[model samples]
Target chain A: MAEAENKQVIFKQYIEGVPKETDMEIKVSKTELKAPKGSGAILVKNLYLSCDPYMRGRMRDFRGSYIPPFVPGQVIEGFGVSEVVHSDNPNFKPRELITGLTGWEEYSLIQKTEQLRKIQQDGIPLSYHVGLLGMPGFTAYAGLYEVCSPCKDEYVFISAASGAVGQLVGQLAKLHGCYVVGSAGSNQKVDLLKNMLGFDEAFNYKEELDLDAVLKRYFPQGIDIYFDNVGGDMLDAALLNMRIHGRIAVCGMVSQQNLSDAKGIHNLFNLITRRVKMQGFLQSDHLDLYPRFLEDVTGYYKQGKIVYVEDMNEGLESAPAAFIGLFSGKNVGKQVIRVARE
Target chain B: MAEAENKQVIFKQYIEGVPKETDMEIKVSKTELKAPKGSGAILVKNLYLSCDPYMRGRMRDFRGSYIPPFVPGQVIEGFGVSEVVHSDNPNFKPRELITGLTGWEEYSLIQKTEQLRKIQQDGIPLSYHVGLLGMPGFTAYAGLYEVCSPCKDEYVFISAASGAVGQLVGQLAKLHGCYVVGSAGSNQKVDLLKNMLGFDEAFNYKEELDLDAVLKRYFPQGIDIYFDNVGGDMLDAALLNMRIHGRIAVCGMVSQQNLSDAKGIHNLFNLITRRVKMQGFLQSDHLDLYPRFLEDVTGYYKQGKIVYVEDMNEGLESAPAAFIGLFSGKNVGKQVIRVARE
Candidate 1:
């Protein structure tokens, strides 16, 4: 292959607080497709990129994080849809549509072919691999069914209701014969939750001054399951409203990320009194159930039982702003960047 | 029968912050134990009283507490060892030694005989039913084995090291071939943790200016299991020092009990990053394991594999002060009051 090249988004510095646009920069670099002749690797041309809130955690220079910090001036890596341009590895063939951990920019050279899963179904939007049919959807399914363990007629509450994971969690709870209520930061998101997402009730947490009172008004019988995304005062309030033997699936804590001073939770004593079970989990930990997750969620989508919405940015340059939007609750549904179209 | 007299301890008012002697008053009242001739009931002479930290939560008028608040001018009830003096119930016989929820007084008329368990072991000290061989022991055992699930060579950390639950957890971890470190408020307690309790290391948290630094210095390999008795800064520090896939068994948050302003934990994001599992549980939730708990702990004590320490106060009058000392970290090991010990 004559003089191949790759376009990539690079981390410039460790984020201090709320990520700024300047923290990331897009640049193009030249690379070899042959992987130095002897090495076994596959070169991929990136198609779709996933903009997830968890990536913000990797931007910080903290020890003991789930994943390591993105190296400065290097391609920022996350789950992406790509087409294999060339392969030295026997498993991967040229022109194969694949999904795996890839760069934020145009192309990537993935050495490990095992990590790249071949896209089984074609003609559907390949970007769905990054959203509904991928990590976020699996997160919602696993956290709800496996962690929360909601029973029929149980009250389910999801915070950050219109976000990627929360949106799917609410819909799944509704499908599970649960009474679902969600809290969002915007009126549009609240409308989407109640009207589009099939939540029984939705409220704009920004408009509601007292979260505890709002929860009481909506869920008089108390919350049976809480899919916690935005942890802070909301978590504290939900603790008070949890029923006996309530289950809280702690997926994320986006609300406390950028704050210089974290919110203090006073109602934690209720965990013991009410016999509440709160568990924190990562989708990666439960990877053994991935095949089942794909079948269940894809089946739900095909049957028109589930709908996934995404806020798509146009290019790689917009990826930084799209990610920063996660902290301020700017995006609706799953945020994605259409790096390239098939 | 002549009119019977009942001696009881009653709350004078809702306690503010740490409880004072003035907050509670002991009084004697007379009542006939007549249950309309057909009612099943039993009158008991209280033997040993259990002074627990969770009772401090009930002292306040908190709405969502595990146990109900002590009513003004009424008996303060808790788990106690008692002997039935009069029985109108078929299950309970007069002179039977029993353990159940009872009043903090000389005598009580218990209507719920089914909730009470008759003590079968005759040779063991009856007071041991309130501490070492009772709820506290079971709490430490279940919380550690079930929640923490420490590996054979894992590093375990326990806060409030010399307290009731913490003391037992340290010994249990040691028995499991895990390296255990503990924190206490005083040097005396710290020494006891290292010397008597078989902790690998112990520290006085009060003397340490930086909790995070203290944890880092001790747990160089990182903590695999953290038995959290004290929350706030210590909990935050433990979060930072936890190894990947660490388990935090949150048994109590005694540090933040009296403070009007509790510290906000900043390192909770570590839960997602490190894939840590932090869970809070009550001893009663694991009641099914009580029989197994009794057998295991009894064997450990009899075989000289486990030793329990108690700081006992003489008479019922000192019970309130003994409980108050718990919040201030004044009492060592299991704080109990010997109210007419057999």
Candidate 2:
């Protein structure tokens, strides 16, 4: 049998500020279809790759960070849905469908079998595992129910409202009987959040003359829970507008991601005055809640209470542009790259 | 009986940016040595007054702040150690030493006697009640033990390390066997923190051209607990140097209190990457721990394990300058005004 040519997205170097598509390179390598002898390894063909805001952190050579930086001249790793072609593991056999951490390539020989989760549930698309049923969905779930501990009838505000996690956070808060509002960069995204995503109110942050004033208008009583996806001026404004005992789940700082120097949050004193709690959380920390999250979100999806919008790009060649597009808000929803058809 | 003359510090107007001595006025008024008729009030002669950083928030007319702004032309209120001269309440007697919220004046007729705490222990200076044994002390205790949940052998960093609360946080962290470092404004304060205060390491932040480099030098292993008293750039640097799962107690932002436009803090992305938790807390929220705190801190003081420094001013006339000096780092230790002899 002959080795197959593997097309992989390789990170060229550590990025300085905003990552351009040129920062990554597509390198064609060759891999065998069989797992190595005397190993619990599984070889899979990558079907879909997830492009998350968190990936930007991996591009920087930052020490003491949660995840390690991707090595230059290596295949960039991310969450992806894959189809098993060869297996030496008892848990996952050949032709089994799974989703977990994998390389952004045509094929990956996963050595750690425990890291890959078997996607056995029916009535769902495999790509949905990356967007609604995987990391982003679980992030929204854990951050809201565990971190925020939100109550009914409370006012909730979400930043980056049109993104994967924000869309779900808004929907979950609405289902909880809370008044939810979101802010996005574009008018189209604002419309998607309000009309398509079921937010009580949505505003284009770029269009607003003052974000603080816009938040004040939407939340007359003040925000009870702010699912902060963009952490610069939005976090500052949210700090000032937080109600007593308000909770801010620091999801991401996409707005400050590419800056050489981050924007300062001046209104942090309000945290003391209002007795608010602002905390940063990562989805990887709440892996224990994965089972419950999948069940609850799956029910919501079946009942038509949840819908995920995916911006799909065909082929591994498009992966660089798709990942780079995340910082610029060029993708409409959960950005995913299709490495192969299911 | 002839009425006694009472001098008071009155807030002249709400401050726009940095507060000046002229923002407050010393006014002479008259008070009888008795409570009003049918009023269950106690009359107290103010012995010592405290100048704390939180008072700056009250000077601004900004709405949605933690506490209401002080009404212009009214007497400014703050913590003070006082001697009761006349008491109509059954709980308090004449000459009973007490400490709590009091007007910055020669005497105050306290109508709400319930808000005051009777001074029980002796051998410690009653003036200590306003600093080491008062709100600042309790703030340090609650913020460290409760909010941060610091562990032994962990690295701890305290900003504004020579002030009332910051001083105690460093001492307590040292007692816990943690590697402690503090940042102060001047070389003298830095010396005080190292020589007198017993901090393992201390640095003059103003002299350091790069705060991040300074922190990296001090905390080579990275900070596990950051007691954030100065929230702008110091916080930004600390975030970069925080170890995994670090907790930041947002005690105060004395550096940012006077700015018209506060310095934007970048590098919050580290919070997610490092799984850090940054929370702001108020001393008032933890009053339930006062009795235990009094016992523990008093024991530390008796054992010579704890000591507090006081920067005492002569009279009510010095209160304005002392309060204004907090932003400029003029006064050393806990800024106290000795209105009269105990």
Candidate 3:
């Protein structure tokens, strides 16, 4: 077994309020770089690390959430693309590319590989296994189609529009023949949404103080489907402007995730007035659609019907700032850390 | 044609804040108690008029709601049981009993008779048609069975548990083998929920200062289905105590209807963590189930498996006060105004 220095990002302690870059620290540790014999584990070198908003939920000392909180003084765990170095599991082979839950380190010994999927190497970017083809992409697919149940020419609104999930949701709604409008934090992201992503309309949410008036201006007839990523004032505004029998797919609450307590939504009465259906879903629950999602999304990407954007940061040391930047809306697209090149 | 003095309750003006008895006035005017020849209209004598919480929405001058608001200086309209005095329409004959939308007057000339249904005298009390077998009862059926999707042994919670819709919702959940708990504004209503309504447990929300703690005390395992009738603080409390994959049926917002601006719900992030589905539905949308509802509920009542409770007022003179009392939680059960008897 060859011993090597494994560079890692470690969780400092349970977080409160907004996460700071100091909450995580970079460290170097010795690793065997080998899987134990008959241990059914695979040792892999991490390639690309994903920074997702849902990861923030893991930083708090709350056991009641879908995923458990990160332990203090441990390697931070997240979705990552990796290349296998050694394997005791018969199913996985050496040099095979895979993606699933992995530690934020240069190398990791994964004992639980049930959720892992082997990369097909179909000319798509390998880093996309953690972005466009990963949880965020799948979240967009499930939330829009299954939860929102979009119809052709129906008015659609999305928050966090240029980010990982919202960007994909907007593109998919456009491809579905929906009149898609998106709101993003920065003017650059807003420009990207309107021009680059082919959204019907885009606006900088940071510039709008009254979201209700802005939503009404964009959708005079009222929004038929709202893909809510940043839940706060925007969610309340969207509720007031929903058309009859509207559907709201509550994907994430990026804006409220930083606060110790979430902001209150005053317009839920609109749910009854509009006869709306507001549902919260996780991509993991809709794993049955993964195969179909991969096939459809891959075909669309190849035919240039859909596009993906990534805000890639260099090295493991940048992982903390990149993850923390999510709360402040700093990243434009799928935020990923490049740990190693293929 | 015969002439009669029509005693009516006229809505004085569009209301703001909680409704008051002064918002309506008793008016006596002459009316021709006969339908015009060649006109497809029916003349009816109003019998039992139902006072519903949703009627408050009609008081506000808002056109975006599912139903249009009430026109001031006109007769207040509501669901009522009536007897046909004269008819020009072939479908309806004189001396026939019916249940549908009618004015709060001694005699009403209903021009649009499309929604009217002839009531069958099956040894059941005629007032029950406006209480247990009317819109409120149907709301309970559709909201509980269709929206909540209650499973056997699941925990169920109902707000305003002794009210028209909530009483029926609690009973139906109990029949479905769920462990039911209900919250009311008074100890008497709580006693009615536990003993008379057959709920497994009941609590007085007015007595409990901390709604979250009270909910935890009642529903230790967390609620699987919450029939939210009075949305505000209790709804926020229910959101925090929901189990994984819980369903919340947004039936009405009696608490919010009083306020010009609705109260904000702060714990909506739990919807994502618990994977909860919160849906708003109207009973009219589920009318296809009405036939089945009539059959099932009628059988339950006949077999002594279900019971209905009513808070009946003496006459149309008490209609204004009875309707206004709903906002203050003064009525214990289904609030109905008995205008005349068979």
Candidate 4:
């Protein structure tokens, strides 16, 4: 066994409002670079860490949520692309690349090997395992296919359209022959959505005064499917412009996560008049479709039918800032922290 | 052709807030009680007129809704049980009993005969055609079976449980072997729900100021199915107490119909955390299930497995007050105006 210094980002305390870099502290601790004997654990050195909006929920002190809150003074845990260094578990071996739940540090002693999957180092970038081929991509797939049930030529609208999940969702819907429209916070993201990602149309929602009128203008016939990543006034606006039997996939509520009392949705009555179906889902719950998601998304990428955008932050020290940047729409696309090179 | 004075209820004007008795005026007009030749129409003598909560929506001058608004200074149109006095349409013969769309008047010359259906003079009361076996009943059937998709022994909750749709929904959920709980505005309605309607538990929402606490008390394990007829604070509260993968059937927003601006729902974020599915539907869209509903419900009534309650108002002149009373939760069950007898 070898001993080493592990650099980590620690959750300093539970937060109330929007997260800031001050809420986390960077520390260096000594650790044995080996899994304990007969512990059924595997130690892995993290390569890349994913920054997701759902992580904001873990910063709160609420116990009623689906995932437990991050404990004060503990190393912040998140999804990451890692390489195995030591293993006591039979399924994982030393030097094998894997992706699943890891740490915001140099190395993690993972006891939950069930969630980890062995990553084949093909031509595809290993960093994509935490972005396009990971949880966010699978989320887009399950939500668009299972929740929205997209039909050919149907009108689809997505908010936070340039974000990790929304970008993938728009591309998938486009590939499915839907007339896709997306709303982003900046004009740069909007330009990328239309020119680079091939969305039918894109708009900067920050410049729009009346979202309802804006939606009506973009979707003259009304939206048949709405992939909602930002839930607030945008959700209320989308509600009023839904076509009959429309489906809304409630993916993430990044806009409401900061407010102590979330903004009230006033136009839900439209849900009845339009006969809409609004459902919330998680990617973990639909892991049974993971194999299919990997096949379809990878196929699309290889054929150049789909393209992924990542905002890579170099070094483990950038983890807290990268995670915090997701709430403000500061990250242009999928936010990832590069911990170490292969 | 025969001449007669047709007593009719005229919509005074478009309403902004809650409906008032003065919003409608009773007028007597001359009429020829015969279907004109080549008109393919039927002249019917009105019997029973249903006063539904959804009728309030028609009082507003909104064209975006599924149904059109009521024309001011004209006869109010609604579902009714009638007798064909004269018929030029081959589908309906003279002197046959029927139920369908009809005017709030003594004699109605219905031009759209496509929506009309001839009724059999079964041993059941003719008024039941506008009530337990009519739109409200079918709404409960479709929302329960199709939207909620109840499973045996699942915890079910119904808001506005003493009203027409809620009462039937509670009964059907009970018949499906679900644990049913209902909430009503008055203690009397709660008594009726528990003792007469055979609900597992019943509560008076007015008595409990904290709706979320009351729901938590009644549904300790959280509600699996929520049949929501009232969509205000109760709906917001129900969102907080839903179980994982809960289904919420949005039947009618009786609570919101009266307001110019509906109250905002603040707890919709729970939809994501719980992975709940909330759907809005119209019974008219599921007419294919009507025959099945009629068979099942009629059989349940005959077998003493279900019961229906009606609050009947005598004469066509009473229609205005009965319809207005719905906003105040005045009617105890299915509200009906008995225009005439068979």
The DockQ leader among the candidates is: 4
Candidate 4 per-residue C-alpha lDDT over A53-80 given as tens digits, one digit per residue, 9 for 90 to 100 = 9989999999988899998999998999
**Against the true two-chain complex, what DockQ does each candidate achieve?**
0.53, 0.65, 0.81, 0.86
Give the local distance difference test score of model 1.
0.84
Provide the overall lDDT of each model, using Cα atoms, as 2-decimal numbers: 0.84, 0.90, 0.93, 0.93
Per-residue accuracy of model 4 over B1-342 as CA lDDT, tens digit each: 779999999999998888999999999999998998999999999999999989889999899899999999999999999999999988888789999999999999999988877788766678878878999999999999999999999999999998989899999999999999999989999999999999999999888979989999999999999999999899999999999999999989899988867778998889999999999999999999999999999889888899988999999999999998998999999999999887
Give model 3's TM-score versus the native structure: 0.99
**What class would a CAPRI assessor give candidate 4's docking?**
high
Candidate 3 C-alpha lDDT tens digits along B1-342: 789999999998887899999999999999999999998999999989999888888988888788999999999999999999999999999999999999998899998899998998998788888878889999999999899999999999999999999999999999999999999999999999989999999999888999999999988999999999999999999999999999999988899988867768998888888889999999889899999999999899999899999999989999999999998899999999999887
Give, for candidate 3 chain B, the lowest lDDT window spanning 10 residues: B257-266
- For candidate 4, chain B by itself scores a TM value of 0.98
Per-residue CA lDDT of model 1 for B1-342, tens digit only, reads: 446766667878777777887788878788564432466888788888999988877777766566677777777878899888778888877789998888898777788777788888646677888887888888998999888888899999999988989999999899999999999999999999989988999999999999999999999989999999988889899988888888888888888777655666667766766777777788888888888988888888888898898898888888888887888988988987777766
For model 3, which pairs clash?
A: none
Residue pairs with backbone atoms closer than 3 Å in model 1 (clashes): A66-B273
Where's the lowest-lDDT run of ten residues in candidate 3 chain A?
Answer: A255-264
Error of 2 at B112 (Å): 2.2
Off by over 4 Å in 2: A27-29
Recovery fraction of native interface contacts for candidate 2: 0.75
DockQ versus reference, model 4: 0.86
